[model samples]
Target: MRFSVMDLKVGDRTGSDVFNWNGLLVVSANTVLNADDIDKLQRHDIDYVDIMLRYDGKSPEEKPAAAIPQENETARTYEEAVGGIKLLFQQMLQEGKISKELVDQSFAPLANHIEQEKDVVSLLLTLNNKDDYTYQHSVQVGMISYYIAKWMGKSEEEAVFVGKAGYLHDIGKSRIDNNLLQKPGRLTADEFSQVKRHTEYGYEMIMKSQLPEPIALVALQHHERLDGSGYPNALRSQDIHPFSKIVAVADIYSAMISNRVYQQKQDLLRVLKELHQLSFGKLDAKITQVFIRHMIPNFIGKKVLLNTGESGIIIMTHPTDFFRPLIQINNQFINLSDHHELEIQEIYMR
Candidate 1:
């Protein structure tokens, strides 16, 4: 079975050779992991691996299953959600339709779990895996959309519904050609146009299925922007559905921070900055601000590396200066809002 590096204990044995994102070997097949091995895997940002078995006290035959560390339970849940989405996507491509029952099974667990899990920063680390970017992106967008809805004062039921919308936003892509979806190189002009049709494809698919109108609209209009620069249909602010706007914000944030075949993952803080910039004309300002406002506070105790090659703990965040926070190095305090020359090069959410 596949286990997240976060979930693997010291005694767990790898079922296959483990490699980092750059394809460098980190661990050999069937290697019995120690504390350092686990730490090295975490440092390498290796998300998951195939585990043959685990070694407990008595003997390998009598060994019990590993107990998930409380800290890593969320990552385990994320892995399950990713698997569910992969199954659902495969079913859609084969069947040419969505199953509401399958959608609930795949997405509901993660959505319910994330609401209780307050460590939003850590989610950025564990919820992502480059191998299955599409499935992982769907889960992230759904979770983020739910948070945006709740933060914006929507009722609980309403928020969950909006989340379902976000979860299915890309279901249309299931009907698209497999070659185009997996292409690593630049997409041709006509290929890009065909890709854009996923919006209409998703809308039609959902409408034909048992899901509601709002979810269908989200699939169709998640790409639409406030300034009418989006695809499928050039929908201005009012013409776009409110739920779609929430999904749009979630979609952009998830896509930017995710590691994909064609695009490398951007720094989390830098992606937030880009979102803030997009809020002006491309995205809905209120919804984007709500997401950013709630997300920036998660950096309070995070470790950050500065552009000057120094590292510090984020002690406090500035209200006016969203990205730059008050960082503490030993007993010295650096207020990044005041030091405009210094910049946060990276934020260590994990």
Candidate 2:
């Protein structure tokens, strides 16, 4: 079967791919669908249907092979796992004993789930739904760090360890008071000091647990800068572990993109710009370049409205100048770097 984006109405059977009553993706096989699942699909504006047929255990010869609807299974599963991790942290804060069984039971499955789908962008985007900043930030860092590790050609085991370190990097923030953590104004010197304590607190918390030594080390060192400007410990570039360096970049990127109670979410392009600027002193220049070149490109698709009232789809991205990209509007290629008049005013994801 050929893949076609067609408006599907309820009860329409285009082929083996049956359009649900609500025009969501559904297979004609004997499986049950749920209300939440349908609602989630609708939220993403997946109203078009595409059908794919298999013959002799292979996809049928079709010119336009169906574009598979991006599955949120990996995302959903990762979110659930992060939720469990959050719960464990909450329990720990309450002085409740963290059982090794619970930690293994929760993280082991999450590790396996992340391993199945190596696409880190989808994983990070999926985990962004969490309303809580700490939990969402943790998952984002994990996914981003995992992607960085993979890009560096690290082994699967090393990548997973990097991911685990990222996930637990901010566990010490659990001890910080909610008022200070969620404050909307600039923090006072004392408040900033308290905020800085999270690194040490997270390190101590992880040290007490059954997690591996490298994971705990990452929690402590993620804040340390290459120029000895980072917090908890002013370790220089050589003093910092490679995993910590990876986590540091991921953590800063996620924090910059995320909307906190005190601060609005920074523009995606602007955040990348800031990261690039800071790469010289704080972040690893090579990894920062990799993140900007590879990871940042994934968030830039979908249509955008230019400041000149021209709208278009982002066609190309620049590694060094992330804020600028070539746009296709009305069948014309407008390069933002050259056409300074045409600036992206807003992005429309549909």
Candidate 3:
């Protein structure tokens, strides 16, 4: 029976393969739909789907197993999770560790928001709060890592797990002194060294909290660069785990794009360009390229304000020009790659 996506619930099996308007198959036939699957359908504007109905003519398991909360419920999920995470960090500072249960309580709700979010470009621009830098960074990095993992073709379970690791990758920073963490100026040699140890502290804390070894490893190794320039163990390229490398990319992007007390946020596009350059030897080349490849496409359908005071809607992005795109304005299509003087100043995200 065809049912509105709004009415479909978790455990509602798809009776047929569901494809988006773009003709991309998102969910397979006979697949048991989860919150993520259902939300993806709605985001794609898929209104009616063939839901498997039992012989009695009702969808199996008439009651949904807590389908991703409706709009009213989900709007509060991210803010509430951030508040809970703030408390978790404070608790970690006091006790030196936080239990797996606590970690789950603070972060699990965000899976709904994370799964539903496709506009990451706007997400980064809008959600960042400089005052709550670390807390917000944790959430953004987790979300970014989750998307990166999925883009790299990781399974849902694996991607979510990687997201969780990214979320806690900086938990050790809670143990550091507030003065050092919030300092507005460059740290002294001694102070910088102390800050770097947060990796070990984070690893120990996560292990003590009974999270997995991989989670602890991410905390420890996320700072480890492809070269031996990073802190803690300084494990180079082949020695580092891919999960840690993934979080590292997420961490750098989040930290750089966010407004820090010491470092002002750069333009979103400029940061991606930097990431492209960093991919050479400092970061994983393949991983960084994958991020740029996927992220560049987000411009295809956005309304943007150019530095030249012109406004246009992005018609399509170019293959090699990562930030430039073909835009439509005043009935004319402008290929940004050919217009070097035109720069995107603002993305009017709705």
Candidate 4:
């Protein structure tokens, strides 16, 4: 079986001799690898190698199975995209500048996946990592932004632009102190004040990179709310760029549904309810409507835990009661619209 170097376990034995792109032998066959060897292989760009199957003391027909190809590929794709994002941030922090080409390269897979699949929820479900919140959040915002723009009937070029803007929106946070960013408790006023500067820092970085005017404005204005309730500038309504408005909605939605340093992830139904409330005064109502309309239906086939300690699969969505859906549990169908006492406690990913 062939496995990417990143997916190798410490006890996995090599099925073939490992070689570099230059065709020189690196490690002989049948060598047991440890953490250090796996890390070295990844650092040296030795992406994949054939691995021998576990040979228990049994008959040949009872050989241990290899990793599932589809599952491995899915895991690899996700890892590579995230690793690229992390590397991009690391490079930017070290160099004190943003690289437009590198940013494009880092975000290409996500953009391509969203463009090809046309389903943002599935992609969002794949990005549930809590350890790398910043990088994952950036990617999620970018992907959600792309879908929102596309759903709102924006041109393909315009949608892609907003997606790119979403991906790079939080680059400014890379400059903030890790202690402040990763604090497990609520930040003090002074710490929060410093945190807010990420917007200005991001704006400066994007502008300095000569990327695009809209992308720079997105970094600057994404935090600004319709009611002038946001930070850095607090420009409201017509003042905020439209692209930034799109990104703002995406950013809020992504953040609310994601696990972060200070909070656990919220249930999707609950997050949507909060977004609906925010739309009245804080977010753009039109964009919020378009987003809600497109997003709620995607939950039809998903599974959710109820507040009553029961789990079920969503079978149908109520048209007006967007949050209440009919569910199937133990061969019984329950319409949540009729069961006012019940609510979704958690959304399970596929």
lDDT of 2 by residue, 110-227 (tens): 7666553432443454455457888888877887787688667688788877887887888888889988888879999999999999888877777787667788889899999999
Question: For model 4, what is the error of residue 195's alpha carbon versus the real structure, in angstroms, after optimal superposition?
Answer: 0.2
- Check candidate 1 and list the clashing pairs: none
- Estimate the overall C-alpha local distance difference test score of candidate 1: 0.80
Candidates in order, TM-scores: namely: 0.77, 0.75, 0.77, 0.77
How far out, in Å, is residue 82 in model 1?
A: 1.1
Predicted candidate 3 versus true structure: per-residue lDDT over 1-350, tens digit per residue? 99988987777777987765545455656656666567667655688999885222254545443443444554467677678678878878888788778777877778755675554675665566446888888888888999899778888789889988999998899888989999999999999999998999999988888888999999999999888988798799998988999999999999988888899876667688889888989899888887876666454556788888988887665656767778888899999899898888766553
Worst 10 residues of 3 by lDDT: 54-63
Assess the local accuracy of residue 176 in candidate 3 as a C-alpha lDDT between 0 and 100. Answer: 89
lDDT score of residue 282 within candidate 3: 87
Model 4 per-residue lDDT tens digits across residues 262-281: 89888877788888999999
Model 2 residue 107 CA deviation (Å) reads 3.9
Query: Which ranges of candidate 3 are over 4 A from the true structure?
Result: 1-74
User: How would you encode candidate 1's per-residue C-alpha lDDT over 1-350 as one tens digit per residue?
Assistant: 99988888767878987766544455657666766567667755789989998766667543432333444667777778788878877877777777888888877887777775544665776556547777888888888899899878888789999988998899898888878988989999999999999999889888877689999999999999999999789999989999999999999999988877688887687799999999999999999887886676556567888889988888666657767778998799999889999988777753
Q: How big is the positional error of residue 15 in model 2, measured in Å on the Cα after superposition?
A: 32
lDDT, candidate 4, residue 294?
66
* Model 3: pairs clashing at backbone N, Cα or C within 3 Å: none
Prediction 4 global C-alpha lDDT: 0.76
